[model samples]
Target: MSSPIALHTIQYNTQDIDNDTLILLYKNLLKPRLIEEKMLVLLRQGKISKWFSGIGQEAISVGVTMAMNMDEYILPMHRNLGVFTTREIPLSRLFAQWQGKASGFTKGRDRSFHFGTQEFKIIGMISHLGPQLGVADGIALASNLKNKNQVTAVFSGEGGTSEGDFHEALNVASVWQLPVLFCIENNGYGLSTPTNEQYRCEHIADKGIGYGMESHIIDGNNILEVFTRVTAIADSMRQSPRPILLEFKTFRMRGHEEASGTKYIPQELMDTWASKDPVINFQTFLKDQGVLNESLEIAIKEDIISEINTHLKIAFDEDDIVPDKTNELNDVYKSFEYQEIEKKPETNQLRLIDAISDGLKQSMERHHDLVIMGQDIAEYGGAFKITEGFVKQFGKERVRNTPICESAIVEVAMGLSIAGMKSVVEMQFADFVSSGFNPIVNYLAKSHYRWGQQADVVIRMPCGAGVGAGPFHSQTNEAWFTKTPGLKVVYPAFPYDAKGLLATAINDPNPVLFFEHKGLYRSIRQEVPIDYYTLPFGKASVLRKGDDVTIISYGAAVHWALETLDNNLDIQADVIDLRTLQPLDTETIYTSVKKTGRAIILQEDSLFGGIGSDISALIMEHCFEYLDAPVKRVASLETPIPFLKQLEEQYLPKNTFESELKSLLEY
Candidate 1:
């Protein structure tokens, strides 16, 4: 690494730091208070809802985060109320958010002042505390990928250090050597629990040592100290990717949440903390240095208050950015609160591969905003060559190659989307998605519910097994994400459907998980539309119909079902291919079961806790009466996928479909 730099805990008695320079720094530090007061005042008048104050913690936040570029990024917790002003977040929009008005930042879809942004890299807040830090690591990783001079400044509470996610993000950041500055605001409490109870370690700064990082313990209220440490760390980060730990010894001075206060705080301890208040201490330190006086301090406060109020006025007075005017369905397949009848094409023409490739070409040709990211996809056009020749047609920026950090890749895609770009991220192997599970479940899936309308990226994982992916590469894992409500999960078996579902997912406002089966990538080839088009989300297709045993499946298993029923005279099995796992096609299942009186559920995922389980449960709830006999399920045996092809063949569900169907039919 670079030469080790030591941060002094001793007094800085070095070269003279000019009085004028210090004053300017102090002015920047105090400027945020103007907005802080304005917001709190509005909250009291019921002009807004509630606030988690940064009233006494301004010096540390302003000093550290302002040292960063706004176009860079930050994942702030509740105490980031101070950085909001430096971020130039419109106060009127904040008020609108507080009042739950249509003019709010998220168009009344989010709470006061905590929401995502399209124009700025400033992320919306996360309610679960440590989850936001995971995103911070992602943003920094994205910066590394894009070759940009930016660092992600993540703020969290001392209490958050106890969460497994906090450690996970830190470990991944260290492993990837990401450019991230972690600021742990030691407000002496972790919610109702105090620091003394939460940890017995010396300090959070020491925690970085385990990750081979340098850390500092700064006076949280001392703007000068904060600025020096944070800037130096940020500068070094840009030079090379490395994690830095910063422990800002600040105090809460208020309750954890808006409605909650620190009544549990003893009056004597509160008085002691008030005496050490960062805002007041920094102001006093400035006066002692002869850099601050009564008149000058008053003037600075007035000017800042004026500046803050002006922005607040603009946000409050300005009109809202209306949501989609058409008020369409939640996703492409399902119109906003409306359903469309999807009739099968009269002709059985295009293979699924051609359809998928054609869809990519049409969509990219139509929208200048769409970008494709994956490994080897640029040169090799992916393992299946679905994206072949696209890089030559569209430049590298639109079809970018990526390093192999799965979680970090997802993080970057999510960040770019949050910044108003439409990004598509690919997991080369579906099993590798385990690497990015943290971002998917904790950040991307929950960002909107935590703040508002934060879904920005669409993730594509090539999933399912048929041609011997064994366990690692072939398993169908759609059910892992289907139960998660916010994300849209699509698994199509044909070319036309893949193109349509992918187009819909790309345009949908929320994050989408498109699971393309590796086995079907080449097997399902067909003539795709030469022009651009979008297929609706939440729609299913019935490929073949019969009044016998009904087989319901998606992705590779659908094709397997088609083959299972192919030329079988004794078994007239109806086939239903559910393109969407999230909004399961219960109607199709019920209709088929009522007509056939026997049913078989099939997927390539593990037999335990997979999509088949979900479908079986639904049938019990809605289609139990139609069952002429017991329902049967076909899925992979419960075991980790083995590398040996023969063992994998036995473990997988492909060979079981025919036999399972026979059992259901005979029952």
Candidate 2:
């Protein structure tokens, strides 16, 4: 026969926690298990659409929550109900959230563990598992910079450790010695993949050693053991401020969700884990220590059941939330009354890159919380040298040099934003953004709509095909972000627009993807304003007025459109520069199209699913009746930009813009 599992006994006096407190911890563990059971029941009754049961792993979350101070932040996963319960989240709110009711934290916008309370210092988890780890690292970084001794606890699964974000976040935290505790609940399986298939290491904590961080494994079934160990770790982290990865060896008794059947799990394995249930084990340990008797256990159970029942009744009685269709566009971008700052005529001409750098310097001087982060942004200035003198002026603390981790750059910005700091992230190249797409599209863009949280980050993307940078370094990928609801896309052509739009993006309360055209960075020079000023988003600049046709473009293509019109004076096209792609200037486009009675949309991105298609559809819907001819769309070919300079120029739509515009004018 196998030896029985060893129990970690707690000494009443030495641990500084009384028997009553231990019992309460046990209660915290049991309450979530009972609530999960109720959620499964509700799932069957169709009251809840889905359920993720943390049935066997409640001890880990509760222990970690009990160990940390109330002010410490926690980035929890979907299975972390114990963390919510220990933080005193009302049972009614949890039910309301699961039921998608108006009283829930998200006001029925999101369902199931996708809500957070800023007051409680908990950031809710998104569907993506790994990105939150990076967010935690950023929070820890901000806390350390602000001289706040707050430890951030982030939870993840063994499966999530395989993600790139897991590595990036740990690497950053280790290098910076940030105050973060990465709690990995090793629950034997990730949805359906077994641990043996996921990784070869004997313990998940072993990975932390490679990152130069201390790692430990704990008996996840023992609540007292978890609390005792985590309390010490939390205290040490607050003092010295280093990350520690804790791997809790536990099991998940239920399937990934109610809809996901448990037939894949073996009966023998289920029986083995059932014998080691955390809640039952904790109750037994308390009963053996004379802290919990049969009558007290019965009374505690009754009180919990009664409280849950009362909350459920209240939640069910609440009115169903009806989404306001009129406010669908609200919160997509920051809305504020427009008060234009006075601008003086400039005498000194600067390149677009210099203008942007100057704007960043001015913004950083004005806002103490502004931070700049990217690869080689500190000492080397950046790949484009746009941040050349930033480190010397702002110091390394404010202008940080990040590892080659793109996702973490955005994730850290999101974290800093949440912690009341503004951050600007730089993607080395537009193509490299594919590596960090999840944080931008899934988390940063949807944070406000899902949880009413502000991810006030500005990601600078150096885009457009020019200088023979080839496919990897040169590509205009703004359409990908423009399609996302919560993101604002800005592409400025002139130095004046570049400086002003960048300032506006930095000040906006929402996330912005500012695409800087590398081709125009040095080629375009203009006398930009010396002082701080912000141009409004969703406003277009009419570069030239004409009665023949309306030419709509942004970034480098706007210049191409202007040149085409200048060369063909008879074409007489109205060139409108769309400074912002998302929250597009539809009114301006419509007004110009109505006057010209013709339209031409030009872009540097590929034709397939490009921004031109969206613009064409918009004009067709709003200005179809005003058109004298079919709208024309001129864009790059649908292929990766070639390394050869001649082929690269051919891949761009600049040369084609003149011919397309002339054809539209003739028609």
Candidate 3:
């Protein structure tokens, strides 16, 4: 093996700190190192499936955690065992989490440091790593909004800095001047890939300068330096709200995980890092300063070992979590029943856009903690002008404008929801949701099931074709979110349903994808009540009742079904408008299908894998015995929406619903 370059020592001053505080920091560092040693034994014995060793990087986690106030939030990555230990989370519960037992933070739903506890003010990172940066921005944003003077500290690896989310999150934090400490643990290797391969910048902190934020690089292996600098920087941030980037240079002493060997790393480099081991180096320093002696060090090690054995025994005695299909399915979403609106008021004729605006305004007035954000949503209103004049009424904080960053904003909404606030994210168009899909599906959707965290967010998606806006701006992609678990999908056809259902969506304790058909925003008008109201999800609205055949649809397709029935009075049919897709109104669908003895499902999305396919399968499975013919499906072509008016009209399912309804009625 080639000889490796020696690492430089970081200068630090600890004369100001008292002996007790310094000893406590040493204990915190030693605890995780010993616990990791025990876990390595468990991994070898096949008791634990995997282990991500933070053996040498303990100083970074311990120092940063000890420096921050207990109430301040921290979002940590996988290799942050010291963060949990320093925060005083029970070892028994943590062991149970590793053992996949019931008492764990996620109830055995997730593994590793992938779980979060609101009680400890720690939000765990998802596998993607980058989203947590945005989530930290959200927590800080909430703290800023409430004037709580709270600061958020978020951690990431040197490799994670390369992700787009890192840039988006840093840019947003810089623009808003949110109080967040962006800590990058530069551990030299990201799963065998070295730092040089990750980016061209001199240091990870350099990226922060591009975002117009103060940046710093510190020696992560030095415990005193880590603690002192982080404490001072965090204190400064609390009094004056702003984002700061901190790059801590450290080395990963072990492989990414135990299973992934260190063969990729040079033997000499590993040896070079071994000499500067944070835990050993700190112990030696403490002994030299007369703060710790050989006997005292031995006593602390013995105590930590005893504590680990006790917790491991408790975790071992716990019953294994056997999976139950029914229980697993039930836990996918939070149990929230339909709520009824209290009072009724006089009605006024309004367009779908106006009704949505009224609903948002009323929701904001009702819930003071509610925040709505989107590009051009505040001063310029929205693309559809749905939130026009909202900033004037609610102020810029509640009704804010966001940069063209869909992914980061979605995660920010999740973070806001995490901090006990309701948030609504508006995508300029439904097609734009693709950019924000990761956090929505992997994090926000699974938060409740995984860690009992409620992401009370409403994402407004302006959808549908026929407007000649082309594929990018115009698309009915409700099916995209409908297939994912833990999200409520709502698409209303008229002004009354739009207003009522939107109110309900805003109040839902889970993430909701509310699709507003841009094509119907101005084309349709109805008598909508000025007072706040709510409609139940998972309950389809029967727009028209007939017995010949059942025609079911949602969003713009519901209007097409009514139009078809209006034109063909002879073709009597039951038309059902599904308000929500995920919590589907299968009861209404089955009843209508059984009574009519036939069914025709319609959708604005393409035929294959669309929501109509699911509806058809359900009807055939439950109501097949009463069927007169096969369940028919009318939908747009399986192709991208066109920009030309003529092609868009042809691409829409409105022109085909009438023909399909007649065919089903005849059969």
Candidate 4:
């Protein structure tokens, strides 16, 4: 193993801070340590499920938290219980959360450091370690835009620095000059992987230099050193608004969790670190400085013991708040009464691209907190020139051109949405959304169901295959998001639906994946309303009504289904456009299928595991007896779209839908 970095000696005058303040600081450090020790006891007794102890790393959290103002936000990870204590989270509530009580932060949905209170400006960390860093960037960005003069402090372990999100977050923060303090708790070991195996750098702070930002390496065990430096940085950041990377060189002192054994750690190293324990060393320093006497130390200990016992009793008495079948569907999506707005007389003939642009403009004009962020979206408009002139109209602050980090884009949007801003993120191509899949699935989609939190983000994906855009450029990946719960999937074919649906997505209080067909951006034009209006989600529009067969489709495929029906006038198929896929307009679908016994489902995605399969299943379940024949599905070939014109033509479902319709009519 490499030799440890040399620690710079920091001197402090004990008299500078009053004895009461010093005693309270020591108590803050003691709170989490005692609580965690008790948590270990509970773990052994089956009172709590797990414990991620921050026993040795108390000084880092308490010190930094003390340095920041109470109004500022702190995004904490699982190991940072000291932060929760320092932030004045009630011990009873903390214990209640650990005990899975009804009065806890997540109402017993999550336990043990997996909960956060927006009221306290604390964003709880998800299972994925690195994405929260990007979220912190978004929080800081929002503060900057709103001129809040607040600095968001986000915590991570030395292991998280190796993740791609760390790089993406720091780069974006550096480029945008966001006010974020990136805190890395260098605990020497990530589970069992040692620092030497994790990265070659002697100090994790060195990575910050490459991002063109300030970097600091501090002795995390020293409370005075951490507080003194963090206070200075936090105060300066409010005015200058720049990100700082601070590495806290510390040790875990325990296993990754209470159940994990420490046999992997060498005995010699454990003994060496035990001597440098922050709590013991700080106590010794206080005694030497004549700050804490034996009598006072005993009194403080008794007081903390009494407080813990009181909270423990209350938490233990609380009822277990487990989810039941009755409340299972509660808070999945925000409930709103839908009111239909009549179409206006004055309408403009717009292409799909222009309608999307206009809808974004109208939404931004209505809500000042709405922000548009994507690659090349600000001045250059976008790759397809959809957001052209947005920067000029909305200004650069609202129209942001982000770095080429798709995961960060989505995660940051989640952060912004959590911070009470509506973020509309554009994936330059639908294929690139794979890079951001984790946040979309794990963080954004599950956030509401997990914590009663709303991720009001609109992720605009330019999707589908046409005009020979090839494999990388043209991909209909809507099936992936449609399958995920807590997400509203919107795929509009015409200009009117695109504008109306996009507007609704912006105003909706949940995460929405708005898929726009690149093939129809300029090819499809219709007379859309000039003024602002929103179409209700989960309401399918019947484009053409007929009695022979019912055809269901969305996005670019809807046009092909309609064209096929128009070409074969004798077929007389009822065409239904499912604009929103998640809160599927099953009422309209069932009604149409009930009317026309024969059904056909069409999609631009592949045949297997496509959204059409879900629709087919839905029809089979509800409209099975009504159907005269088996539900037929027409979808693209199960292969990557090729670049050649003929292959690309063969890859889409347009031809397949036409052929399938002919066979369905004959049946």
User: By TM-score, who's the top model here?
Assistant: 3
The candidate that achieves the highest lDDT relative to the unseen native structure: 3
- Residue 281 of model 1, lDDT score: 59
RMSD of 2: 2.6
Q: lDDT (0-100) at residue 317 of candidate 3?
A: 98
**In model 2, which runs have C-alpha deviations exceeding 4 angstroms?**
1-16, 334-339
lDDT of each: 0.72, 0.88, 0.90, 0.87
TM-score of 3: 0.98
lDDT per residue (tens digit) for residues 592-634 in model 4 = 8899998999888998998889889989999889988899998
Query: What ranking emerges by TM-score with the best candidate at the front?
Result: 3, 4, 2, 1
Score every model by TM-score.
0.70, 0.96, 0.98, 0.97
For candidate 3, lDDT tens digit of each residue in 1-667? 1122243243457859999998899899989988898899999999988899998899999999998999999999889999999999999999999988998998888899999998899999999999999999999999999998888999999999999999999999999999999999999999989999999988998887799999999889999999998988998998999999999999998889998989999999988788778877777677767888979988988998899999999999999988899988877887887789954779999999999999999999999999999999998999888888888899999998998999999999999998999999999998999999999999999999999899999999999887899989988888888998999999999899989999999888899999999889999999988799998888888988888988888888888888777888788788898888978999999999899998888888999999889889988889889999999999998899999989988888888777777776666
Worst 10 residues of 3 by lDDT: 1-10
Model 3 residue runs over 4 Å out of place are 1-12, 342-345
Q: What count of clashes does model 4 give?
A: 0
Q: How many backbone clashes does candidate 1 have?
A: 18
Evaluated against the true structure, the overall lDDT of model 4 is 0.87
